[model samples]
Target: MSERSFRQTPHTSHDGSNSSRLSILLFIFIFIVLCLLARLVYLQVIKGPEFSQAAADSRTLSVNISPHRGTIYDRNGNVLATSVDAMTIYANPKEIEDVSSAAEAVASALGGDADEYAELLKQDTTFVYLKRKADMDAAEALKSEGIVGIYYIEDTKRVYPYGKVAGQVLGFVNVDDEGVSGLELYYDDILKGTPGKLVVQQGGGGIPIPGGTEVDEPAVDGQDIVVSIDIDMQSYLEKRLAEGVSTIEGEDGRAVLMDASTGELLAIASTPYFDPSNPSDSEVGSDSLKTVTQAYEPGSTFKTASMMAMLEAGVVTPDTTIFAPAELSADEYVITDAHERGDMTMTARYVIQDSSNIGTSLLVENYLGFRPLYDKIVSYGLNGQTGIDYPGEAAGYLSPDVDTWPLITKYNVTFGQGISTTPLQMARFYGALVNNGVACTPHFLISKPQIGETLQYDTEQIVENTAAIDPMISMLETVVEEGTGTGAAIDGYRVAGKTGTAEYVDEDTGVYAKSSYNLSFVGVLPDASTPLVCFVGVNEVPYERNTTEVFKDIMTEAISRYRVVQSD
Candidate 1:
């Protein structure tokens, strides 16, 4: 064969082969393109509505199911505060085409004026909350009106069934159902349930399609809390204390009943307390949980600590005699007894019974002196915060340094002047006296357990001194039987307590004000067994003489309410 013919023949065969390969590749590419086009058609037309609806559902408008706040119950499982399902009214301003008409319908149905509702509906925002925590009846009425823009969102409304009974202690929630004060604020995380999300498709009119829906994450409810409080006793104490405050015409008062052994706070109350149900109606001044938060000079009630110090330092005994006259000089200040006792020599028990400043000052000076007395007070947990579960606890003012002690410091401290202590701190100090001199840190919450069970937190005994407690208990008993706290005596129960009338200091002059005083009574119930330690303080009382009355009312009510026996 010729060379040219051979080259041309090979070229022709190569061209034909290349063309066939290109055609096969084209066919495969066309098949893939056709398959893709078919899928697009199926998704856009044949099954488009279902898929598109699903996509739209994926874009969710959620109503937050704020977890049901955990129920707060007393030790006996009496409900203090609980969460209930309620409907919250919200408006989709975008959906209201006829603002005036929709607003008029909503206003008539929901008991509001039409103009206000119309203005709310005309706002530019997509969502506007009309009212949170609406009752079932109100929600139903609004639904019946068939207002175009209005919607109901499910939410948890905090309900304090007992109302003002434990208002200060239970605390109420704010508009958004968030705890704003009291236990509600303190235990917000634990009590606030986890919020959930709801996913659903919105139709043409922005209305949720129920059957045409997506996935929903159910909300987890909060765990319940069982407090150390006793509801019956708490209610009784609140009622009696309120009555006493009103009758005495006292400015304000607070009372706390605690289990001496366990440091379990049985009942806590403050006068002018707010009702958690209608928080809007509550006065701001009455909202404080004063028992654990407010501090005041304990007055002669602190003599218990002084007596303990003296006994602990081996300075005096129950029978040890001291010349408890009208006044005794300590440092540059002269401390005098409430009543003049000429040149009377009295035992330590008598001194406590008389609530004598002279006797206590002399006794403290003779035995504990300055350093030891101050140290003992600090040891008794007086100078520091009690570390309670409640919030806003004041550690109180204890001159950080004794060297900075004023000239009258020693004398003032001898009789609970120049010192400040919370009611809870005083109760714990007294608790130490009755509980074999072991000062346990006081706690409000009994325990925080997992869902369905109650956990009991262990009591921490901060101080253990057996030497001083017995003698102190004896002295406290004497005060109840024959001392200034005689009015605190219960028929069936032996009581031990002290009365304190602390003069408030004039802010401008830094001197004791003659007209103002904080009257307080600190006592231990069932004197023989010494199970409960209670402290009631009324601030800015008009007369110091009425201090004993405050003690009597609280003690009597507490004794009768708790059924504490005299002998036991």
Candidate 2:
């Protein structure tokens, strides 16, 4: 209205202002369009693959595939330990429509509590393991029921065919097939094969897509292990040893039979042995293979090593005699024969044959000396592990300070009262004694793939003076023939053996128990030149009971199985 007087002037002003406003609006619109275009380029070019991968990852799932564990075979191709094809029961809880019904179906097939199965099926998780390494037959039975969301994957289960035979030696595995003890633990790496994988795309409702992107990487199987254990022999030994131990009502017993020439561990057994099939029921320490794992004062069994030392060192001869008294005092300890007797003159042979403690003491203290005796003890592996293939071998106890040994300690070690040794060590010692002074390695593994260093047995001469072996063996023969080990004698076979009746050391007091004794017999069969070393020992007997019955039974079986020629 005011512009009526100056209409022309006002129109120019308004037109100029409107033109400037339009120009500013056009510039803002163009800048916004350019910014949107830049954003499009950045997303489509720079972040495209990132988003695509994220979307794909949301649709994929990966699962591990277990490889087949290798089989364990005995020397005669008998299966000792092996893996059987099985199944792992798993479930998709989210996909299951009727959790209660599905769980009942699974339990009915797998033979479990339906309530427990229901608890598992009610989980919010997409994937759940209903049963790991379930029996194949059981899983198949479950599959036949066609339970919704229940599934199975291939797996393996370790099994021992021969129930309790060689159970401790064979050891047992966990639910995942991992070895936990004995040879199974010793060779776990070789037995556990490399695992594989299954990568598949998850489709709608989190179920595996059918005919969708899937990749399967095959598993590499483990290598097989072949051991020297003869299943038949092991089975026989286990039965006889258990029977023998139970008969006397002895606390426990252990027995080992070895090849005199080869040092191969033919059979090892102990009372109250483990059953690999039911490892959960085994005693805490019973999983140990007592033949190698347990060490105790060997009594007269250890005398053979020291006696041989005396002969080799020229301190005594087979014909040499020593005055063995009914009693002798060395420091604070009293030394005496196991049986009460009057003082008598005895040859070196009688010291071992009669299992005379006083006689053995006189030789070591008066002639062999502590230092030489200690050296001999180590040489025979009485004070150390024999490097057996088995795990947890006890390195026998021997005092390092021989120079400071008490006179009684020195005396006691000569007769195996102070020193300790395992049945396996004693077996190996006898093997070397009869095999021309060469000790073959005590082993169970015969052949296997070279995983690490090849297994080598120590064939070094433990008995340095080979000449002394024959004489020592002669004395051992007399023991079985007429000495304390007369109970070990077998008809029509010239057997050589030694009896050990050392008192058990009190676990709490560290002193010899008054009533308990570790009764043991170590022997060789046929003759000294060709022999089979057998060791049988029992613990905590009420009185001295001969372990020879067990030895005779086992040896008789061995003679027949090995075709050992009868000694004339």
Candidate 3:
């Protein structure tokens, strides 16, 4: 055993142990560095955006400020619809510490289920509305609660001052103050203005920081609109039409009154009207503006168009006479008069006065043919929608392709038995007659471009000249004096109009109902000066007579409102 060998062995062992220890320490240091680098990448890249958004949401509160809706006014400056300040309750879900407790507080204040509100409070969104257009008292009470994460934003709520006076015309808004029907929907673009934004710097728990950075985009309020409806007249018509429907044993009633020359709708009424203030308090179909949306057969009221056709073609004069039997057989269908009558002779005036379907059919089928009558009606704006400032205006149906019509169709259309029309369209046609054969576009909004958007004034010559209206006017006067529309006569006023009784075509059967009938009357007051057309119709009327008296009541009120004087 040499001293050198012992020393070498101990050194080798000690050096090996030290080298192993150093290698292990270096490996551990490298592993820890790699792990830290990966954690850093995750925190800075993958989860960075999430954390940044959460922090931002807690540090700043951003909200949308609703703009004020435009006011709706009638022709007489009556407020039909308007807006008022309201509050919208919302929650900052990101800042809510206890979702259930916050939801319970909101529900108790707002009269809602706590579980339902809890679901909304637990949403992933930064902002959740507890209630839109909330009651002011309720909102104030909740504000006083000092609940964390609960906030409110100022908003606007729609109000109809007249309640149901012009519900179909004014319509109603949803909780968001958005129009959903009628003229409100038609002019929603002008009624609903641009929304603005508000950003407020906040501290922990979404609490507003005093004197913090605030950015606001001012809201642009909606422009006002003026329509032609007379609020007082509209109210009177509403009451009268409801009464008319009940008295006639009809399911519903509708009417339209307009300036004969200007085409401005003065009053529109429908039974079972919806309340614009409380939309839920309405019947199913009552929300619809039936005057423009629903259409039905016109019956003998359409004879005016045919009478014009005969006069325009020079086929008949007011004195021209025709002999009609009890029933005429054409196209294998028996055509009879509106009232049961034996063989009789009738002049043009008498035919109109009596509403003689057979006589009109004989004259049209034998003398003027159907083309002139069809063209005359289409020219008077009865063939399509009147282009009114209203939503859901239905275009009245007219049979096309004159050559394709059956022989009976020609005669039936002359008496209005086979034609369908709307009350608004009928009012428009009558307006043309009163305008001496010039059809003005029917509308509710008057042209006021300086204040808001409006359509251009337009007119069309329905006839070559005024010659075609002279004889027709004389006969229309005769109708109210002694004809079927005598009930529509207004004392001391020179009135002219026509009556209509049409069979309701059942949807299930696709044919005329045995007992149901649509009764209607259209009249014009002071046929010469400042004429106003009043048209009324009732659906599913069981009686033979139409709504002639309803027209009288409505016209009486209208004439009184306009201060119309007595005429010879």
lDDT values for all models: 0.77, 0.82, 0.83
Q: Candidate 2: global Cα-lDDT? A: 0.82
Clashing pairs in 1: 492-566, 493-566
lDDT of 3 by residue, 1-568 (tens): 6556434444334788899999999999999999999999899898899999888877887777788988889988888898888899887787788888888888888998999999998888666788988878889988988987777778888988888899988888777667899888888888888878878787765566667645478888887888999999998999999998998899888899898788888999777799988888788877789889887788888888888888888889988999888898878888877678789888999999988989988988878877777887787777788888788888878887778998888878898877788988888887887787777888887744446556566888876657868788789889989888888877777888999888778889988887778888987764545678888999887768679898999888887789766456
Sort by lDDT, top down from the best? 3, 2, 1
Model 1, which residues run further than 4 Å from truth? 1-60, 203-215, 328-334, 341-343, 447-453, 458-464, 506-510, 526-530, 547-550, 556-563, 566-568
- lDDT string, candidate 1, 1-568, tens digits: 7566434444334788899999999999999999999999998999999988777655546666667888888888788998888888888788878887877777766677899888888887656877778777778888887777677767778888888887888887886667888888888888887777756456654565567544477788877787888888788778777776776667888888887887888888888888888878988756678888878888888888888888777768899988766666657667677775687888888989888887777777676687777887887888788878787898867775777776578768888988988888998988766676666666667656564554444454434557666677778888878878877776666677788878777688888777677888888863444378888877777765544555666666656666666554
Worst 10 residues of 1 by lDDT: 4-13
Better of 1 and 2 by TM-score: 2
Candidate 2 lDDT over residue span 30-138, tens digit each: 9999999888877887787888878876787666777788888898889998888889888888889998888888888888899998998888877888999888889
Candidate 2: where are CA atoms >4 Å away?
Answer: 1-57, 212-215, 449-456, 508-510, 526-530, 566-568
TM-score for candidate 3: 0.86
Clashes of 1: 2
RMSD of each: 6.2, 5.8, 6.8
TM-score of each: 0.84, 0.88, 0.86
Best by lDDT: 3
Q: Rank the candidates by TM-score, best first.
A: 2, 3, 1
